[model samples]
Target: MNSLPPLRQPCPPGTCTCRRDELLEEPGADLRILRLTRHEEQRLLERLENIRSLADLERLQQRMYEQLGIRLSVSPSHNEVRSMRGIVIDFVEQPGLCRKTRQAIPAAIRRGLERQPEIAYRLLDAHDLLRDA
Candidate 1:
């Protein structure tokens, strides 16, 4: 068995489920939070309404970085350093996604995020902080 702890979903506190999504709008203690500008929100929502495949999700992810300047490198639980791809994968899998796309988003996101880098959670340990102590 792998000695590493299981990866926690990168959902922000209280916003993991669709039931509490309003809290996401208000913001909370997510490590790498993506704060959206009004125009970006509008554009993202419009794009989400039409997402049907992995490509669509990838395109939106790129658009957020390129156009809106929104990118989050989240440390989900102080162990996992999730890149933008991982963050976007988590975001795209939210319940807000259309029902037609919901079931497949997780798998798609997994494939995409895995392609980004190794599954190793790059975290800072006490040793690194105080070397030779």
Candidate 2:
């Protein structure tokens, strides 16, 4: 009779099933082995720099809306605006939008404007204020 090696226990719920030894044995096992080009690195750095703080992120969102006719809502309350920046970043990273950030923006703005013209007008007003400043 042939004897079998010990069987490993299953992973906990929601955990990956692959064993650490199995993963390590694979060539180029890490996802980040595919590296970014110099330009891609620079762009990533720029994006990171752009969102250093809530105020900076808010300005960025407003600029996107103003320049590209994309209407995104920032909260009326200052505290809410700070919290919403993280949400905005997540929204921008969502997949299946044709990889054209500018393209989806205008449509988003249009939809928001249709639902809440006052918000759109407020964004425009903020743009004017920034321009004057």
Task: Please report, in order, the local distance difference test score of every candidate based on alpha carbons.
Answer: 0.39, 0.39
On TM-score, the candidate that comes out on top is: 1
- C-alpha positional error of residue 129 in candidate 1 after TM-score superposition, expressed in Å: 36
| lDDT for predicted candidate 1 compared with the true structure | 0.39
| Model 1 residue 43 CA deviation in Å | 2.8
TM-score of decoy 2 = 0.25
TM-score, one value per model: 0.27, 0.25
lDDT of 1 by residue, 27-49 (tens): 55331223443344445555554
User: Candidate 2, residue 88: CA error in Å?
Assistant: 6.3
Model 1 lDDT, residue 6, Cα: 29
Query: Can you write out model 2's per-residue Cα lDDT over 1-133, one digit (the tens) per residue?
Result: 9974332233354444334345446775532211223344345335534343445546756754453223345433322233212223223331111223323444443444445455444544564534536
* Per-residue lDDT value at 49 in model 1: 47
The segments of candidate 1 whose C-alpha lies over 4 angstroms from its true place after superposition are: 1-40, 72-133
Error of 1 at 96 (Å): 23
